[model samples]
Target: MFKGSFVALVTPMLASGEIDKDSLQNLVEWHIESGSHGLVAVGTTGESATLPMDEHIEVVKLIVDYAQGRIPVIAGNGANATDEAIFLSQEMAKFAIDGFLSVVPYYNKPQQRGMIAHFEAIASATDLPLLLYNVPSRTVADLKTESVAQLAKHANIVGLKDATGDLNRLAETKAVVDNNFALFSGDDGSGCDYLCQGGHGVISVTANIVPQTMSEMCDAALANDFALAKKLDEKLVGLHKELFVEPNPVMPKWALYKMGKIKDPCLRLPMVLPELNSQKLIEQRLSQLGLIHP
Candidate 1:
């Protein structure tokens, strides 16, 4: 179903910034063991923006290989240009990825017609089922529920990743979209509410650190166990907020490094470390939760 606790997996790097395959594979195996439903590789968490084309594809290919049937790999293939997105999605499709997570075009800020054409072009060029990603916070172009409804009618466009953190439109999209198309929340903090409000699940950066927590939360919500879901949600609230204290993946990488799950906690250019004050709090919570050695 491609729903529920898809980790926006970070591309773990060595101190010198080489792709840390050993750590990446270990993380994949860990997610499967931890009950993650799927894995999203080369995403914002994976630092896709900084990765070179070849390296990006290589990361996707490697994750597909290492996962070795353990889980589905939803490769992030977003770009400002439809043609570029097409080429990238096609390249990524050569691997064992189960689907593509393409974002709404950014920077150039295309209009609604352009948005329709962009996704339609990619869907035309490749057969990969797509989960449309709309994070206007980063992309700057919001896809209205109307455009999403239009796109969902396409044969290959399968679902949406709603990062706007607005439930009103999510309810609208879920109400109007074709029968089989689905919706997923990209925001982690209220992801439980989203799922219960008819979203299929989440593409969660929070899952990178709390894989089991996310998976369990989604399962609880799906089973209509709000009481249990609330308890797990409480366990993850500080984690969900702190991970985004600055830029995403910065604090997430930091938390994982302290857990000995990763090597150096470095992000690529244009992304910097969080403030020193916040790092202590981040580590403090991790210690309080016993995620790190005290």
Candidate 2:
């Protein structure tokens, strides 16, 4: 049931590097008002790597609490350790979250069989629907089409967020799985194309800065109006490229701060602010899109 622009929400942080509850709640309200289809809390764009387990769980809970069932909140339950993933899913299942976005096991690089088993175990641990996430660029472990087809058999495993950005995988994976199984593009750049080619939606990073455009684009594509979708997507093409000028939330958070959506653009250690040049580029894109003043 998860479709449209599901923003990989960036967790707003205070100057002290603590979660900004007010900004988090404000973001949730803003997304709902802005017509974003869903929110993926604590995902990679949310800086899941830097957040400790307690903080991770807390963010998901806070998002769920703030959303109040207006929009779906997909918790990022990905962990390299199978048991840790399962535990995170089990814990998040206690909240009102709609599903779990479990990424392919990273760092360790599990085999296809291991990946299947890893996902199956997490799916079995909770009743919430599970969406497989395959962003091999970061995870280093690709979930093969065959493996994804195998995991799609589980009743709780409903969909996948394929970040490989390879559109060919769309037809290839669709050929193997049932039509009802949702395939969401995790890459924002090709998101509209993916939808035009039969993807259900996008788990978008760009949506963090431009929710309305992303939502409208996905809605148009889903409605089979490709011309409108492409038009809307063109407005986001620059944002899609520039937001990744630095690693994920660094640029997104800074964009939000510039737009007055959040207080501090502070990231945890290891993910500092974007370089001055990168900031200038991001600002240029934001200005071009009229998201910020020149």
Q: All models: lDDT?
A: 0.88, 0.94
Give a tens-digit lDDT track for model 1, residues 1-294: 677789999998887879988889899999999999999999888998899989999999999998887788999899897878888988888887899998898899999999999999988777889999999999899999899989988999999999998888787997778657868999988788888877788999989888998999999988888889888898878888888888888899888888989877888877776788888989998987788877
lDDT of 2 at 121: 98
Give the runs in model 1 whose Cα sits over 4 Å from its true position: none
Model 2 weakest 10-residue run by lDDT: 285-294
Q: Give lDDT tens digits, candidate 2, residues 190-221.
A: 99999999999999989999899899999999
Top TM-score hit: 2
How much is the lDDT of residue 118 in candidate 2?
94
Q: Give the C-alpha miss distance for residue 93 in model 2, angstroms.
A: 0.9
Which lDDT value does model 1 have at 15?
71
